[model samples]
Target: GKDGSPLLCGSIPGLVPKQLRFCRNYIEIMPSVAEGVKLGIQECQHQFRGRRWNCTTIDDSLAIFGPVLDKATRESAFVHAIASAGVAFAVTRSCAEGTSTICGCDSHHKGPPGEGWKWGGCSEDADFGVLVSREFADARENRPDARSAMNKHNNEAGRTTILDHMHLKCKCHGLSGSCEVKTCWWAQPDFRAIGDFLKDKYDSASEMVVEKHRESRGWVETLRAKYSLFKPPTERDLVYYENSPNFCEPNPETGSFGTRDRTCNVTSHGIDGCDLLCCGRGHNTRTEKRKEKCHCIFHWCCYVSCQECIRIYDVHTCK
Candidate 1:
């Protein structure tokens, strides 16, 4: 049995001829019928772990086992990508059913499934890595209508526009109440900061403080009256403000304003900043109640004087 045959030579790895290394590597990497059958058997074992399964027919066993093997292979590819790239990823147990409301999947029968895991990259530019599955590829190709609907939704929801990248998760739970097909996408945090920055641009600094209160009923109403025509400040506006001499000295702080003894008194300046009225003084004098009771006096005279000053002399003009 120890004859100098090719099979015997190949079986002994170190003894194999250098010329045959390529062939050996190819054989090692290539898929085979035996491997496929073994994979099918393993999948069946995973699916019915503790059950005594009696296959009624050969066709039934093959039908039941085929998809499991296919799924395993797909998952292996995803795992390989994760390992190679040193990226963290996760698989959802099921597809997002209610996402139609947020992601707009209702208008169409089926949509691009969200699944897979995301990894944080070192740089802002290196944000995400994705491993697409064969099923996802096929869905995109075969289902034109569904794909189109998803594309439309992605555009509308700003997912494609806002998100950096997307990848399919190589896992599936049974498609029942909601399709268990999983998928996921990556987004940059800076993109979400736009809304907050825009809000701050339109609102006054006082409005920002009042918004933190428990009950500030008239703040929005007051702001709307004056700043209805105000647009969000752009980069140009910020640059101009930075370069302007009046930007910093408009309201120089004499001392810390919100301490227990001497609180910086806030007054209401009407929509045009033309009518300033000191509605109250001290931290506790606002329409909204403070956490601790304050001893500061709420002077009506100061409120009236401030209002008169703003209207008559433009005392609180923005620098």
Candidate 2:
């Protein structure tokens, strides 16, 4: 126990070089970092569960998504952005919760007091979280390639989403239920809200073209909007350089597992609808019985008794 040996930071898998450096330097923050990555991944799956890609992860490898993220598709942009945002969100939350000694609540007040509210509570320090996320997530995009540029942009967009949603949360202080003074603090939005915002960004993501030029050191790739009339995407908009595959059939080339057995909503006309999810292949319907507690009666002692009931419903899956 006395020996100075690297513990958790040394054993974590899938970290690139720069991330390893950051991990070793800030070992105490690693748990929050891991939690952040998990949050990002879980949110990604939740947001894409009804879609073709589905944000599936590989169990056998550290690169969980495998080569699915190797391309510069809109999916890749969403993943990068969400992951980055997740890291920041988690770390910022940890800071407010007093999990780390290196950081704590933000004491800097941006402006003067509003109406009756004054800055007094411990505001979440998101800037530190963003810095740590950039150090680790941006480390993987060191190369001067088009994909790297696209990824970095999307990552920033994810972090910006958090910043954009930050708002003042206030509590009232007064005599006997009357409002007299209000203390406020800056707080991050709920992670689900962030996920929903990112999903919206994914749907309307901008398509970009790669432009390579010679610099003093070597060639560098930059991204530009493909369409001329469309307004240029800001720092908060997701950008992709390549289109995603249809993912209708299993194709190893495009890293698509297909939607052959995916569940579909029969009544929906949107992306999750059988018509779109099945790709015109139609769907198969089968009856499923579900058991649940049905009729219940309150007893004299206050406990309730319920009868078991069986219910039948139609289940649909892509053919």
Candidate 3:
């Protein structure tokens, strides 16, 4: 019978009904058997998906085998092992070939003697490849383009390095130097880890400013309280106390008391002139008048008066 379903066994031409019962039973069980094989294939695909490998190659292999292995045999353990091995082999081969092509290495050559026996140099290049593979797996699981995801990772790494270098150099200390312009590279996703580091530095600076202001305020308060008690003097007091007349007591025996009538001849303006000479009284008050002469008072009391007056006036004038 040329039915639409695929033939599992050799075609049997024109057989009787009872003769074909055994064959029919086997045919009846084929869907269940195929279901088991499908389960095994699905498990293998899951395991491969979990492994880190190139996205393009994995997708291509899955697309090719998806329909062909839909009706595969599940009765034999050997077939299951072979299928799993096949999947693993395809993934590993794709990774190895891609690495060799990028690094200009011959994939056919055996790598150095080791347990894993890989062909790559197993240094920086291998590590980079491993990182790429892990990122590729992530992209696959997330249903994104692996190449674009890898590019994003590389760009972030580069930006992070630049931000870290800038942060290190920008000490902002007066002893060192400050960054002429402030930057918030810490807010970027790539530099998020160093955000805490920058925040600690910023907090430290803020604390210092607050402490300095507190100390300055304390010093000003102390000065204000100390100088609050003294009062200053006025300018009028300075002038009056500095210009008063001084007197000494007169001696009566020397004709220095009440001798107002005595006169002396003196030359005044090229002519002879007479002037009166007398000590006015026996008291401490003495007075003498002379023409064209400026009089000044000299006494210890006057000196002290003037000095105190000037000192007090200066404080008030300053304020």
Candidate 4:
């Protein structure tokens, strides 16, 4: 089956040789990788919708991932975690479906402690998904550097978050509508839920040090000593080695394209507000008329109709 199922990511451009090899090894995981990447991009866009970067993606290749990931910034940390989590969620959910030959009910988890429901209603094998995802994602950072360590840890955190959110779902069925039978299974949390969780982690991501130490015993990280005000970083936390730029003006050095020509919410007072989004550059307004369907009415036959309406609105853009 692995032979027949070619990895969807095998065709992806810009992947290094080792990454290609990893995908080939888990061919069935390929589809999950593809789906996961798309979801990751979407989640990034959602999370950064009002920001300068705006989490844009290009279709030609993975270059769209850009130099952002190359740096150990908060943005990169979020990208890694969200991407890994997306893959884990996709693969885990795939396991429970009839079409998935690669995985099925988490044999590891004993079903619901003496369940009254169907013994096993095709639960998602979340552990397997997390493991494979970690292997592939963490492999790239095998180098002996503090950045690599942080990346690996964040990757694991992503998988951990996905696995943590796997919930037990149940369904009820019975003859004559009696409440006698029930079916339960493990279900993957919605990708949005994972995105929201990661967003929270991103907001409070830790900044760490890449210190050099005597290797008498072994090579170990020493972040606690540097950032003593906070507790040691946990598997649940997102970690970064560097600070991010304000991203106000186009700076190729930091991969920021600036906010020029970008839309702004003139009336808001948050980050999306014109003052902030324009970066003290101010904004220009233009009025336009748009048409939309309105005054819809539902019919007895489950069909509805609507009439066209026109409205005018002001548009604001960064100078």
Candidate 5:
């Protein structure tokens, strides 16, 4: 039980000193924090699987992403956002499930009820989740630099993604499922929904400039959009300060592994296509034979039979 105890927060990987302190204070929520990080990383990989970067992680270091997040690129912004959102989402879910003593379902609905529906059921305590996530995740960032400011903004954007997607769920109560009265409660959208929304924001991420302000407490760094033609990014949008490297070839400087053996679509004109993914270096095509079950027949005696078939397809990879 000692190894499995939540109080062993110091054993958790990828946690900074401040985060370790936070974990010890909120021991019960440590599992959810770990779950949130896993969720965020998984979603990052899923969202960028076909792209050049592909959200690769290094197993050698507790930093997890190696030097990939050291730069304030759009890729880093997306990672920060998704990771922060994962923590909030997981904590909120745990609260709704009554797994913690400090928090529970949200009972802070304001205003009058809707026409026919009244508030009922458990609304997830998203505020508590977001607050805890901020306290824990932002603790690691103690620097007063442009990259830190960018990361903080992107992190909030990710958590805001969860809040923005919250919807009202209602249950009908009446005779034979008739709509005599309805009870509605706020519910969180699926994590995939948050990932998809953030992916869109990543595509349209705003480029920003560092503004240094002289105050009583030394110079403070802030971010402002480089382009002012459109509306500035709100709390729900991602922001980046630097341009990303072309990850077609292995670059130790940028922490890019490249796409040497990565599969590419021969016909697609998008980022996943051979042309873009290979960085105009051309691709190698190979014929692969795959075995599958074919010509299946259902027998009248509750048995089914199928014939084995060999299928050949052309596979393309970056040169």
Candidate 6:
């Protein structure tokens, strides 16, 4: 499964081949692209684990992803950002490892020099990753409509986050006990960092507007004037064109699968908590018991002994 080869986008049922060709030069990293999409889905499900609409999948394997992305809700913005960031991270790493030839270590501005370190290691090329991601992911957003504009902008925002989070990592040497001299290199931040940053953006996502600019003679989408009270959004901000549904009941049209029978935290007062998740239908609680290794005693050497312990806890689920 780790084999590196040319991936034909059209071979996948739900994948959009038309826009994929925009990144034809990156065909060698096609496996990375598919992995990125899966990573995005996983991240989405993780982020929404406690919420009502918990990122469920459709009948087709990855086929529903493109259409699900077309919606202009806050969820859609998060999906686009996470998915695009996944691609950027994957391709950049592949480039650093010599698996892909279209890109290499970005020797651009290394970290600050006063830190007593010299840049040396081959860092992943986030610049190349972002460029390739924009070409492929944004290609599907061809319409001049607001939804398309929002998608393109959110996709770019995701790629930009990868570049913004690239940091300098270093190793010290040359002296017996001091870091007087060191070798540092730019490294892409971990996926969790990207996921956390994108989650924060998702929490504050703004509902936006798409309109024709008479002077510019093209379509433009931006945060509505009402949403601009604090400040106008920079290019990096995530913007959406529609408000999300309540997501309390199964609405096939809106993509909500409802929260009935979903597990919840009894102590939580927020979305994942029993109150909100059950939508006031109230929840059922049952006692669950399990056995686990416990009451352990440390041995003089490398081994420890333990006795089985029975644990009982209350499990809560929507009625």
Better by lDDT, candidate 2 or 1: 2
Every candidate's lDDT: 0.24, 0.91, 0.26, 0.79, 0.90, 0.78
Total colliding residue pairs, candidate 6:
1
The TM-score measured for candidate 1 stands at 0.15
How much lDDT does candidate 3 score?
0.26
Comparing 3 and 4 on lDDT, the stronger one: 4
Residue by residue across 127-223, what tens digits does model 5's lDDT show?
8999988999899777777888888888999998888888999999999999889998889999999999999999999999999999788888989
Regions of candidate 6 where Cα sits further than 4 Å from its true position: 1-7, 14-24, 59-70, 174-178, 213-228
Please state the error at residue 109 of candidate 5 in Å.
Answer: 2.4
Better candidate by lDDT, 2 or 6: 2
C-alpha lDDT of candidate 5 relative to the true structure: 0.90
- For model 3, the superposed segments whose C-alpha errors exceed 4 Å read 1-25, 52-79, 82-319
What's the TM-score of each model vs. the native? 0.15, 0.94, 0.15, 0.89, 0.90, 0.88
Q: Encode model 3's per-residue lDDT on 1-319: one tens digit a residue.
A: 3242234333543333432443354343323323433433454433332111101112444343322212211111112232222222222333334433333222332234333222233121222222332332222223133222222332233222222333111122233455333212111122223223322221221100001113533421111111224332111010001111111122322211222222222332211122212122211222453343224446766542222111111110000
Could you arrange the candidates by TM-score from highest to lowest?
A: 2, 5, 4, 6, 1, 3
User: How much is the lDDT of residue 275 in candidate 1?
Assistant: 24
Best by lDDT: 2
* Model 1: CA > 4 A from native: 1-184, 187-195, 203-319
**How would you encode candidate 6's per-residue C-alpha lDDT over 1-319 as one tens digit per residue?**
2233225554555445665454354567777776777777788888888988787778554545434554688888988899998888888888888876566777776545765778777877888877767776787787656777788888988988998998888888876857888877789998888888998998887667665554375655434634667676666788887778887887767777778899999988999999999899899999999999999999999799999999998999997
Q: Kindly report which residue stretches of model 4 are placed more than 4 angstroms away from their true locations once superposed.
A: 1-12, 58-61, 111-118, 175-178, 216-225
Per-residue error (Å), model 3, residue 147: 36
lDDT of 1 at 10: 62
Tens-place lDDT digits, model 1, residues 182-270:
33322233322322332232122111001112234421211111133555422211101111111111122211111122222135344
Scored by TM-score, the top model is 2
Q: Please estimate how well model 1 matches the true structure, expressed as its whole-model Cα lDDT.
A: 0.24
lDDT of model 4 at position 266: 90
Name the 10 consecutive residues with the lowest summed lDDT in model 3.
235-244
Q: Model 6: clashing residue pairs?
A: 14-63
**Model 4 clashing-pair count:** 0
